[model samples]
Target: MDHKGTIVMQKYELGRLLGQGSFAKVYHARCVETGQSVAIKVVDKAKVRKAGIMDHIEREISVMRRVRHPNVVHLYEVMATKSKIYFVMEYARGGELFRKVEANGRLPEDVGRKYFVQLIDAVEFCHGRGVCHRDLKPENILLDEDGGIKVSDFGLSGVAECRGADGLLHTTCGTPAYVAPEIIGRSGYDGAGVDVWSCGVVLFVLLAGYLPFHDTNVMEMYRKISRGEYRFPSWFSPKLKKLISRMLDPNPSSRISIAKIKGSSWFKAGKEGEPVKVTSDGDEARRLLKMNAFDIISLSDGLDLSKLFETESCLDKGCRIMSRKPVAVIVSRLERGARAAKMRVSKKDGGLIELESRDGVLAIEAEISVVTPVLHLVEVRRRYGEAAEYEKVLNEVIRPRLVDKAPSSLLRHQHSLSPSSGARL
Candidate 1:
């Protein structure tokens, strides 16, 4: 309302219009109390109700609340009156990642790798929390002041509960260029698999400065996607080509997973020599897992609006085990077990232990956190490599060594968020 004369909300002073869509408009705003900049998405309740998309709004809110990661956009809070709903979110000063690609025909390999790494990390985190972003494109990825990624636009996201009895997500939703081949078949598809396909497209666009599949005719472009037709430019490295090829595989089951992507030589090349902090103190590790007020609110069913629309599922893909052993004892056992399994073991900061195969085809990370005075949680996740190989190692080597069995609980972590992209393709 500073210059446009639009009536501003009591908590925020609306500034310039950032963007808009069919039923919502996003505006730059500042908190009246803290003066912190934020993006406020103003939605017309009547319009969404008329369009019968109240479910979409509710789902978006639910998914955002569940996912809190650094590379993804954050939803600060939601406020609603009789006619409007406002989504207060983080303000990304660097604007849309699409604009960067639009201005620069192609990005340097290092720059593209940097963004791709962040993108994969964030996407993997969402998948771990049982959420899949159905729409992933440069337009939906924003850049923060430090030029890091902040993935936005969750209106098309699907949670685990959205899957049918066939164990596949049925809804066909995504941009034509980025849509997976299975989605085009009108058959059920795994939500995670489709997201991986879109990520491959994004990586291709980032490096080549153009879509892998393109045609003036929309149907033709989709046909290209369905046929798995795409070519690499002359400048693409052999390693990059190999990785992308696996990612773009037409067969969803054969397509490379986020784990394998992390283990790829090209991906690891950028991460080599990065310092990782390691801690053996149980008290310190527990302090790191401590929750804040917002986290408490996110975990509360009474405060979640999505519950009104649908029952929330407790499905999580991450693997966790409880142990009564001391931090040092657990770390020692993990190192011994990893070495026995023919893996190269290394310690990283934050009580993380990294295990990698000799051929560099598989990598797994184990993190230790003190859950209580007597209980410690060891969360094991595949950073990169084949899923089968990871499972084999976990079952044969790591799990046998850890003691004290208890039901696995959710891991609490806080992540940054980005502005909402009101527009949709």
Candidate 2:
């Protein structure tokens, strides 16, 4: 129950607060029906909106939906009311991995390797699905009841759709201590490469009980990171040293890949020697991506079309255009426009289509949803590149092909429709 003494959604019994941030709080909760423990991340909608971080929440949801692995924290479902959004997730009773390391100092080689292998397995699964957890650090990694790894916190994650025309991620966001050197340089960087670099830093911390690049001054630490200036402890085994060296290579191109890391002698020592295979249910994942009635209502501001279509403070975040044409016709027109503009178009599940420029300057994702039998709402959002470039593409390609006119009252009445009533593609 909450402070009001009412169960959350009549489903979860909220417990003590576990953690909090500027806009969100995590609570320990139990299912009223099953008595199963779970973590509920309660996000204040007003605060998030005021901070203009709704995009981060949306991206986190998208990334979590795409990834499912034993070592990754699971998102059971999302719930929202007028004031708050709740993320019901798996509860890791063992708590943050950082706590364990902090209390016990450096872990034994075998123990550290076990956790690292699990971390890599989970990371590999995410990368396979084109999701990169930009912030990979000890605190973000949780531990299950059995002390196994459960990676969490994906607010900074990026997906392949976010790559620019250059086929690289441009955002430089991560903890300074664990940030990749290339990201510090402010040049375009591969998502997977930056993740690998952070993983290397994590490994060093696990074995050495200290950051590889550290200095009293922040600038000095960054210089050390840029130079890849770090030394292994004398106690580190030859194989471990070699593997860490390759992983911490200053050159992103030469940095060890996940597959190569798995094949390394140190990684396979005292173990089964075979790489773990992580697989996901594609059909189920796609199904989960579909917006239910509740989700639609939550995202669309209780079916208020005006609020949904209103210009955002930042135009690069997204925009909605209503179309009178059929879904098939809209898609056809979009593809034609993309081709004419020398952009590549790829269709995805749930009426999502991706457009990427040949010059690698911009990438956008457009999702079409049925607002009514005769009306469709197409949401176009930039995944990468400058707002000006995205706007140019929107004007030259998307707007001409998809925008029919301003949205009508029909959308405002959509609150009465069920998921099966019409609001699906």
Clashing pairs in 2: 165-360, 166-360
Worst 10 residues of 1 by lDDT: 416-425
TM-score to native of every candidate shown: 0.70, 0.72
> How far out, in Å, is residue 130 in model 2?
1.5
RMSD of each: 10.5, 6.8
User: Which predicted model would earn the best TM-score?
Assistant: 2
Question: Can you write out model 1's per-residue Cα lDDT over 1-425, one digit (the tens) per residue?
Answer: 33343444566888898999998999898888888989988888788878978878877876786566778888887766656778878899999999999899989999999999989988988887667999999999999999999999899998755666455788989999999999999999988889999999999999999999999999998889988998899999999999999999999989999999999999988777866534346545565356444433343322335332233422222355667798889989998998898989997643468888888877777767555566566767666566688779988899888845543233222112111221110
Q: Report the Cα lDDT for candidate 1.
A: 0.77
How far residue 367's Cα lies from its native spot in candidate 2, in Å, is 13
> Model 1: residues >4 Å from true position, as ranges?
1-9, 277-295, 304-425
Candidate 2 lDDT tens digits, 180-213:
9999999999988888989999999998899999
